[model samples]
Target: MSELVDLRTSGRTAVITLRRPAKRNALTIELCDLIRDAATGAVADGARSLVVTGEGTSFCAGADLDAVYGDTFREALYGMLQTLTTLPVPVVAAVNGPAIGAGTQIAIACDVRVAAPTAAFAIPTAGNALAVDPWTIRRFSLLAGNGAARAALLGLEKIGADRAHALGLADRLGDLDDALAWAAQMAELAPLTLAYSKQVLNTVFEPELDAATAAELGKSFDACWASEDFAEARAARREKRKPVFRGL
Candidate 1:
């Protein structure tokens, strides 16, 4: 229902497009909530499959820098990503262009990805002195590989569409049309079976955490958000210079 996101249904397939080309469809708290609603709305509208894509040259550049450090931003972000992952029907990403940071997380949250030649994925959190949730790290490693994860997360390398497909980050390399077609085909499958398999896969892959481990992970993630390095990164952006992180 939000102007920032468009939802349309064709037969049993629903398409959700991020519509802010001016900002490369970057996520804001509002945008994240809209996306989460769109996914749920599509399913409620009898959609058996869903395709997520962007309206512009970039799928999503990342979160808007101005709002990225807000207290509620992480909750909004992970809520949307979790909705995508837990959706009853299959969700496919049509990566039309660069999917950076939270954008990469969105793509991975989907059940399958169809990337355009221009599509590339990267989570430059380390470079920006930020951190992603643990589920994102695990999903990236499982979908791609631990080696690819190390390269992207540790080495700070961008994985192009071809490399993504080869590394299993992308299930296929194709354009929007191809992605839509794939979604339509998936819609024809038995809904209950698809939902059952999806639930099982998600449950089996999830890691159970005790209170101590959970507290530690939360502390670490919160530290990055509160760190002086993140402040420096924002300052550097405004100053039009490279950030010098002290890891403080």
Candidate 2:
């Protein structure tokens, strides 16, 4: 329904594409809303599985700088990521190219990822003196192991598609066509089985935690958004220079 995102179904598989190539499929507030809507709408439209990818040479470059520094953006982004993470139908990521920042989040949110030759992933939060929530960090650790997680989040390493597949970050490496075929195959399986399996996996490692830990994690991540380093990073991007993070 949204011009920002295009949804099309193929053999019971719904494919959602981020359609903004000019900005390298960067996520805006409106785009985030459309992404969440597309996921829900696909299920409502009889889709048994879902695939997400980008329109051009990128899966997603990340969130638009202008929209990513505030609480509104964080709330919207978390909602979309959370929805995709817990979607009833299996969600696959057809990672066409470089997926950075929020783009990385979208890919990891999916139940499976099939990457193209050009596909690469990075969070680069530390490079900007920023941070992600504890849940996201924990998920990355679980998916790729503590080594890769620390490298990506702390050392600012970018993982190529092949290495990602080897690290268990990506399930496979292929084009959009291959990803769609995989989605179709998944769609034909029993829906309830997939749903239950997904739920079980999600909860298996979820620890019953205190409210204080949750609050602390939230505060630490939000604090980065309002810091001088965040502003420095934005300015550096606009000026086409390396950000000199002061850790303030």
Candidate 3:
């Protein structure tokens, strides 16, 4: 099988590309492990910055449903997300297309996002009968807003790149060339300074803002599990029928 992720270094910048286009670059366990290794290696190799992007049409469609439906795989997936959160160097997401569900999670895990004009963002977990991870929900709320994040998660709304930029989900909206230019600029900064700055920012954001948001997300997940829609969807799926989710 082709490698799930590709990593390359250009000068002081490391570019990590999600390569599973056949699956819309979904975050699979193997793919997540590759990303974790790449991020760690980039820092160890003295790279000043890391840029993550998708290889083809879609940036990422989220977690691989077939994989995550298994409880063990779901836990592994969450562990990978935690690994991303702990990366030492600044991680920049070069969003080239649609980023939904776990795709949005990965982008938000990065310190910044540079999205293409054609890119779109969404998190339809509530509608899809799944719950977004706690960190993802908090990160989204911090990057965008509680209201905007709720709209995407709870209301299942999709926002275009322009709107995402305006809402603070994306730092810039441009093409691959623009993303590369921005990454080059970031690579020029002192590595220690960049790392320290990212550390300080995370320190201030995590315990205060993110902690509370994460707790709320857990509550939301519990609510989702207790909902009638969850049971109905489960039943419908087993019966090989289309689920009419009411989002109860």
Ranking by lDDT: 1, 2, 3
After superposing all C-alphas onto the true structure, candidate 1 shows an RMSD in angstroms of: 1.0
What is the alpha-carbon lDDT of model 1 when measured against the actual structure? 0.94
> Residues 83-107, candidate 3, lDDT per residue (tens digit)?
6676776778899999988888888
TM-score of each: 0.97, 0.95, 0.86
Show where candidate 3 strays beyond 4 Å: 208-241, 245-248
Return the TM-score for candidate 1, rounded to 2 decimals: 0.97
Collision count of model 3: 1
Report the C-alpha lDDT of model 1 over 41-150, residue by residue, as the tens digit: 99998999999999989999999997885579989999999999999999999999999999999999999999999999999998888899888998999988999998
Which residue runs does candidate 1 get wrong by more than 4 Å? Answer: none
Better of 1 and 3 by TM-score: 1
Candidate 3, TM-score vs. the true structure? 0.86
For residues 1-248, write the lDDT of model 2, one tens digit per residue. Answer: 66789999898999999999999999998899899999998898889999999998999998887667587887888899998988889999999999998998999899999999999999888876667778778888888889999998878999999999999999998999999999999999999999999999888875645799888877777788889998999899889999998878
Q: How close to the true structure is residue 212 of candidate 2, measured as C-alpha lDDT? A: 93
Q: Residue 84: error of model 2 in Å? A: 0.6
